[model samples]
Target: MAFITKTHQEEALAALQDLVAIPSVLDESQAKPGQPFGPECLRALEHTLALCESLGLRTFKDPEGYYGYAEVGQGEELFGILCHLDVVPAVGQTGWKTEPFTPVVTDETIIGRGTQDDKGPTIAALYGVKALLDAKVTFNQRVRFIFGTDEENLWRCINRYNEKEEMITAGFVPDSKFPLTFAEKGLLQVYFEGPGSDQLALQAGGSLNVVPDHAEYQGSEAAAVASELKKLGYDFQQQGEGIAVAGKSVHSKLAPQGVNAISRLAEALVNTGEFANPILEIVGNVIKEDATGESLVGLFTDEVSGSMTLNVANITITPESSRVGLDIRYPVTLEKETLVKALGEVCAEYGVTYREHDYIAPLYVPLDSELIVTLLGTYRELTGDMTEPFVNGGATFARAMNNCVAFGAMFVDTPDYLHQANEQWPLASLYQVMEIYAETIYRICCK
Candidate 1:
C-alpha cells in the first residue's frame, strides 16, 4: 500500500515549497468581488487547482473565487480530503532563520510559514491521490481535495463550497496530528467595548487565532510601566517614549501554553499610572495569569472536550473607541448561549458591552461512526499505532460538516509550530505522510 516513490516525494516537496512561497495571508484591501479573499489567496487557490489539473484530476476553480477543488474517480459516494491554501501573516513574527514565505530546505527538513500547519499536508494529499491514479486503481468512490482560502479567518471558502458544491459523504481534514481528533471544542470570539478615551491610545496583536507575541505602549508613563513590568518580573524593553513586552506565541487553542503579551502589557500599563479602560482592568487584574475562565467567572469544563480556555488575543484603544478581543474555546457540551450569557454578565459589571464576533459550535463524532472507524482502522493497519481518537481544543474544517474528523499528516514525533516563527517540519516524516494518505485514500476510495 506504500505506493509513493522517490519521484512522488520530490514532487510533493516541490509543490509544498511553491505553496509556501506565496504569502497568502488574508488581505481585504486588495480583494475584489470575484477574488473574495485577496490576490495572493486567489493565486494560491488557482495554483493548487492548476497543479491538480495537470495531474489529470478533474478540477474546478470557483467562479466567485472563494474556493476550488480537485477530484478523482467516479462514484455516487464522495470522500473528501479537506485542506486550505491560505496561511497566516508572517510580517511581524521574529526569530526566523529563513524568510517565512521562502522555503528553506535542509537535507532532513523544510522550514516555512505554512509547511507544517497545512501546506505540507496539502501537497501530500494531492500526490497521494496522484500515486493511486498512477497505479490505475479503480475507485469505488470519488475523492475530492477541497481547497479553501479563508480557513484562518471566516471560513468563507468552505461556506461558499457548501452552498454551491456537492457535500461529501465523509471526509478527513489533514490539519491535526496522527491517530485522529474526534472532538473539537466550541470556539467563540468576543469583542468588548466601552466609552472612548482621549488619553489612552494603543494597539496590539494580529489575528484572533494566534496568541499575541509582542505588545508595545507609547505614553508619558512609559517609564512607570517599565518599572511595573520589571517588578512583576516580565521581559520588556523600554525605549525613549515606549515600552515593549515580549511573550511566546502559539495557536489560540493552546492559549494556556502561550504567554499573551497583550494581557501582560495591559496589566503593566494599568499598574504604571495609566488610565485603565474597564476591559483593560479586567484583563490586567482578573485574567492575570489564568487562561481558564475562572477569572471571568465562567470556567466550566466537561469530560468531552477538556478545559475552557480563554486568550486575550488583542487590544485597541482610540480616541473614539476602546476595545478588547477575547478568544475563548469552551467544552463541546456547553452551548454558545450559555457561555455568552455568563460572559455578558461579567462585562456588564465592568461597564463594557460584549458582542460575538465569531462563533463555531463544537464538533463531536462518535467512536463507532463509520467514518471514524474507517479512518481509525486505516491508521492502525498502516502504522500499528493503537492510539485512540481524541478530542482537542483546536478548530478545523472537521468542525464544518457532519461525518468529518481531523485525521493526521503529523505523527507522534512531529513538532508543532503552527502560528509561530521558524515553522518547520522534517522531510522524512512528510514523505511518510504522503505514503499514509495514499493508502488511506486507496482503502476508502478503491478497496
Candidate 2:
C-alpha cells in the first residue's frame, strides 16, 4: 500500500487543479485594510492546511497565519520539507497570453502565476507526502511539511513559524531549481528619498524584486521628458494621470540583466534636462555606480549574494517629497553593518535619507552535509539525473529552518515563467516532482 499508487496520482492532479483555481496572488490592495500579507495569501494557506487535514495527516497552525505538519510517519528527529503558497501579484494587462490568474492547460502545461514559482510544487509535495503515507513507510524520523504565506515579498510567515515550531534535523524546499541549492544570498531592502518634492509627478514599477516590464510617469513638465525618450525610440503611453514606459519582463534581477523600469525612468529624467532635482541627480549617480550593497563604500564586493542589485520597484512623489523602494539582495558573507555604512555614505553624499527594512541575512548549509546528501540522493534516485547541489540568489523557506535546503519542482531545462507573464508548469514535471518528494520523504524517514 505505497503512496505512489495511481489513486495518489489522480488525487495529485485533482488537488493541483483545485489549488490553481484560487486566485491566490498577494493582493496589494489588502495591505492597508487587513494583514500586511494579503487575505488571498491567508486563504491559500488555509486551503493548503485543509488539504493536509483531508489527507489524514496531523497538522499545526498558528493564529498569525502560518502552518506545518507531522505527516503520517514515525521518527524522533524531524525531517522538514519547506514550501510556500503565497505568490507575487500579476497584472491583467501585462500581455499575458492567457489571463495571469486563470490556470490554463495547453500541451500538458499547467499555466498560472504560481505554477512554476511555487504553488504547483507545493501541491506536488503534498501528494508526495500522501504517497509516503499511503506506502505505509516506516522510519526513524518525522517528516513535516512547512507552508508559509509570505515567501513572495518577505519570509515573515516562516520567521514566525520557526519561533513556535520544533527545530528540524534536515530537509529541503521544493521551491527552487533542481540538483540542489547549498547557498542563498542574503536579502536587504533599501529605501531611498531624494530632494525633489511637490513639483515631481511620477509612477513606475511595482515590487522591488520583479523587473518591471512597463512603467511611466507624467506631469505638467513631462512633455520634455517624453520627448527626450521618444528620440531614443522609447514609446510612452499616457494613461490616467501619468505615462507608461514599457520593457521586457524577466526574473532573477541579478542574472539575465533586464532593463529596470525605475532605473530607466531616472535615466530619462537625467537625459531630458530634468536633472535639476538633487534627488534625481543622486539617483543617477547611484545607478552609474551600479551599487546595490555596502561594498562600494569600501570597494570590496560581498561574495555570498554576489553583487547587489538595485531593483527600484515602486516610486511616489508628493508636492513635498519623493521616495523609492529598492529591493537589494545582499551577499550572504557581507556584514549587515557594512551595508549600513555604505548606505550612510551614499545618503550623506546625496543629502537623501535612507533606511534598512526587511533584512533577511543569507542562509548557507555546507554542501556536504548529510541532509543535503540524502535529499540529493533521493532526487537522483527518483529521476536518475546526476546533478550537483549549487547556490541561488532567490530566497526560500528552506533557509528558515534549522536543517534544510531547497529541493526541486522546476527542471533545470524547463522554463516555468516564475514571476513572469503566463507562468506555467508541465504536468509531467509535476508528477516527477511528486515522485521525487515521495522518495526524499521516504528515504529521510527510513534512514
**Alpha-carbon lDDT, every model:** 0.88, 0.70
Candidate 1 Cα errors over 4 Å, as ranges: 89-106, 111-113, 191-300, 309-327, 338-354, 387-390, 417-423
lDDT of model 1 at position 346: 86
**Model 1: lDDT to the true structure:** 0.88
136-209, model 1: which lDDT tens digit per residue?
A: 99999999999999999889999889898999999999998888998888889999998777777889998998
Candidate 2 lDDT at 127 equals: 89
Q: Write the per-residue lDDT of candidate 2 for residues 1-447, one digit (tens) a residue.
A: 134667877788777767776777666577543355667776777777889988977877666555445455675787777888777778654868887766777668888778887888888888887876666667678777788777876577788777787788878788888987877766677777865566566666677667667766767657776776676666567676566777655553462276655656666777777446655665544562243533235443444446655566667666677777777665656677877887778778877788776676677777668877787876777678886767773567776765677778787888748788878888888877788877777676765
Q: After superposition, how far is residue 378 of candidate 1 from its true place, in Å?
A: 2.1
Best by lDDT: 1
Where does candidate 2 stray beyond 4 Å?
1-3, 26-44, 64-76, 87-117, 153-156, 192-252, 255-287, 290-295, 302-305, 310-327, 345-353, 388-390, 415-424
TM-score for each predicted model, relative to the true structure: 0.72, 0.70
Instruction: Name the best candidate (by TM-score).
Output: 1
